[model samples]
Target: MSTQINTIPASEAVRSAEERIASYDWQEFATELSGYGCAVLPKILTPEECKEIAALYPHEEHFRSHIHMARHGFGKGEYRYFKYPLPDLIGGLRTALYPHLADVANEWNARMGIDQRYPAEHKDFLKQCHDAGQTRPTPLLLQYVPGDFNCLHQDLYGDLAFPLQIAFLLSEPGEDFTGGEFVLTEQRPRMQSRAEVVPLRQGDAVAFAVHNRPVQGTKGNYRVNLRHGVSRVRSGQRHTVGIIFHDAK
Candidate 1:
């Protein structure tokens, strides 16, 4: 069973998000970032932007899966995040988007008085990671394998920073697949679950922190940290375009 969202296009969503971000004031946006270390900007990218990215890659019939899990659940998450294959796409994205994303990241850093702001250097770091990759959630991508899933985990990649990442949901998620839901949960001593079965549409995106308490589970614990993962796609395939920001080493 797979649920499809006949929503807007990717390019349109990206354009819209770009427009919104362009006008967004860092001072005000910081409130949400401080609360949950993330915020959801709707219509982030239009369907067309999604297509433009897909068009760049010629070898896209390779939709596969990878099964990953954790202590929380059985069906954690599935891969096949983006149309571009690994390594190449990873380097391309780092080179292409890093420079452009720098201006915005710097603004956010300056406004927040963050100690780290190294978009240009980070681009080079990612380029070097084309072959050697790690699980710290850098500017790398993972392919999806049937019956495979991702488990809840924290994205601890660098020393410290704000707005650590901005991921693009290339696939429209829904209940059509058995699992494959974007389950985001807060981790506090209380262990409450503030999870949303958010299967963001292909043109939409949700950004979060590398470490923050999940809204529900953060009562008793001190900085329990936000954890998210995929639930597993029993039926169809899932795709995504993920980009992570980091401080230079």
Candidate 2:
């Protein structure tokens, strides 16, 4: 018997995403990420694509697992991890984004005095994660109803973790939801934590540090830990797609 190969159809969403990424001002993005520990990319997804992803939240077949944040003390909402052979739209974003972020990750690792440089291709990095026995998918879609929220936390799944991750807002801030803003907090050495609210409109995405980032200090570059979450939603509903490059155990 001959084995048949199944190919995914081309997605306009993915094509558009590639074009957007290709046009990004990496120099500016790098400067922003270095200064603030995060960077924003607007309109990575179309409004229609956002709506489509949000609609997929209710379909269990598309996901490998569902997690209730409140059950784990993570927060009050829920999220579902995409199964292997992730939808083309999601997979394309991951593939298109990896190389650029890998460069930044390598740079940050060097500056922070850390070892382990990422590969130029995302597949090579995934092989590393799988070799370490982390075989589960980590990209997920999060849904929040009114009064729902996520607590500040890191997305580290296993020892092998990518330095950065991205989250795209699927719902309009005021029209589809309210008060559920993306939040990032940094813990500086010998100082109180500083919090930043990242204002995101529908289709806008934020690329942020997964754990710690290098910050220049009087002595030298120091590592500042980062945690991200969502504020409580006061009304309507909120949805988002989180793209994590590393797999889970």
Candidate 3:
């Protein structure tokens, strides 16, 4: 007997992604980002959609490069960066999510006293990255089995860095994985580092700062540095898809 796999058409996938993205209360998302440096966009993808994306992990044709975290001292497990002409669902999410993120990113840059601003569209921003010779795609699929974890680190790839990115949990927390939690750390000037463990369910996406974000201080807005990673997986398997707006050099 043979099992059949279901897939969404490119047009339908893009439409679904756009419609779901449009339904969110972005003002609340922006507020959350301003206060915490991260915000959850719950159930942005359906469980079946999550499974479809995760199922692409072992296919070599879909990716540009593969990375083993341990070889780079980036902790354990492995990941693969997608090539240009990204899979429709991933590409759709990337295109649909950027404008909203750009608004928040531009505001953060202003508050942090950084002069950089992102373009209003994802394609225009990619053009900037490409013109600067950072042409490699940044979106990736990560897989971790038991005993794997990631180190806290920023996702900056080139001289031009987008302030925010998103990661979707493609596996169910309790059933498909265990003990591997999404973690973010913030370091404020002249103070201790603060850690936050974000709880996520299957198909949920978390948007977060890629490097620096502004925090309101008694005097004025001050910049805080942030790094994100994952805790060790105690049992089962886990998968995630990351959407980074800027390309790599």
Which candidate number maximizes TM-score?
3
The list of candidate 1 runs beyond 4 A from truth reads: 1-20, 23-29, 52-137, 142-146, 158-163, 174-179, 190-196, 213-222, 247-249
When summed lDDT is taken over every stretch of 10 residues in candidate 2, the lowest stretch is: 1-10
Off by over 4 Å in 3: 1-9
The digit string of per-residue lDDT tens for model 2 on 84-199 reads: 98877888899889988999999999999998899999999999999999999999999999989999999999999998999999999889889999999999989999999999
Give the runs in model 2 whose Cα sits over 4 Å from its true position: 1-15
Candidate 3 RMSD computed on C-alpha atoms after optimal superposition onto the true structure? 1.9
TM-score for each predicted model, relative to the true structure: 0.54, 0.95, 0.96
Local error of candidate 2 at residue 215 (angstroms):
0.5
Q: How accurate is candidate 3 locally (lDDT)?
A: 0.93
Supply every candidate's count of residue pairs whose N, Cα or C atoms clash at under 3 angstroms: 47, 0, 0
Model 1, residue 57: displacement in angstroms? 6.9
Q: What value does the lDDT take at residue 122 in candidate 3?
A: 93
| lDDT per residue (tens digit) for residues 172-238 in model 3 | 9889989999999999899999999999999999999999989999999999999999999999999
